[model samples]
Target: MLKVNTENSVRYKGKPKKTSVNAGRLKLIERNKEKPDVARIEKPTTILRGMRLIDPNEVNKNMICSNCRKQLAFNHIVEEKTTGFHHIWTMKCDTCFTLTKCHSSKSHFNDGHLYYDANTAAVLGAVHSGAGCNALRKIAMRIDMPVLSQETYKRYEREIGSLIEEAAKDSCQGAAAEEQNLVVEHIDTLRDKL
Candidate 1:
């Protein structure tokens, strides 16, 4: 017969023995415990309507040189061109001498060239609201904002006017079809009753 100690049995379970904590790790834990828990929140990008005037300093602060990986200051930027509210900036990286072109607004390829979405929207809104170019110019002047030229507005109007007309026709046709279907349904109900 094998003699076994019941107190030191293989199946005996007890509280785990505490291991010696490293002084450096213990100090780090204590330091972390003293500090307040901070929740980091990220800024959200939202699709904005109307217009917003952004400071040049803000734009400069956000701009980084692609080649040198350095922030491009306002002095390093050269104003290349301005198309309505859209502005083209040519940045010369001082360290690498690399020329980088940046646009204030995104451009869509329309026709043979590029067109700013803001300019198109402005024209469309003006036409739809019956405000016209004059009213838009007046509003822009009052706000000290860049006004779209009458000629450019006219060009966009010409391009978008046809599309608006086509959309209106489509809407009318759909409405007529729906009306006819309702009439047919009503006639079928009367015939069923008779």
Candidate 2:
């Protein structure tokens, strides 16, 4: 039986030696170590940016007449126009008889044409998420939410599809140009070495 000495054996008490890190990797590590500024983070004014499934009773409870400062009754909603997921409600104040137009989503103007933000977003989101109009309609139906017609969905899909295709072409061209530049630089370096 062989006995080993434990007391005389030198144990490392100093800090562990760090392995060499690449300059780019070191920068990433330093960046990740930095704490984000909590004060700089802004909270969204509304619950969600796009369409939200809100109860009609909740809207009635929170609604106030702009002119009279009285609670607007749910029954006072004179007209409602739904475009895809977006909704515009025209309400008449009982006290002041003032008509107020409420919009569920903001409007964006492009080439002098007004487009609902939510409606555009819905089509874009559907395409990005690999979901079609049928899928969206089924989900809406299941949730008891108002569903957009196939015609309306198809119209937005066509418009957005063209835009997406254009963007993809631009991106591919940019990437090709960058790759060509890199190849040219590499050839120049080889010529210099020769």
Q: What's the count of clashing pairs in each model shown? A: 0, 0
Model 2, span 1-194: residue lDDT tens:
97655544333345332233344556787886795655656432231223454445435544677788787754667777777687767778888998877665554465788564677787788888999898988887777667879998998888888889999999999999999999787997878889
How well is each residue in 1-194 modelled by candidate 1, as lDDT tens digits?
Answer: 97655543333135332233344556888997887445533333232334544445535554678788887764666544656665556777889988777555455464668554667777888999999999988987787667789998898889898889999999999999999999787997878889
- For model 2, what is the alpha-carbon lDDT of residue 43? 37
Give the true-structure RMSD of model 1: 20.7
Error of 1 at 116 (Å): 5.8
Residue 113 lDDT in model 1?
81
Global lDDT for candidate 2? 0.70
Which whole-number lDDT from 0 to 100 does residue 93 have in model 1? 88
Per-model C-alpha RMSD:
20.7, 27.6
lDDT of 1: 0.69
What's the residue-level lDDT of 28 in candidate 1? 83
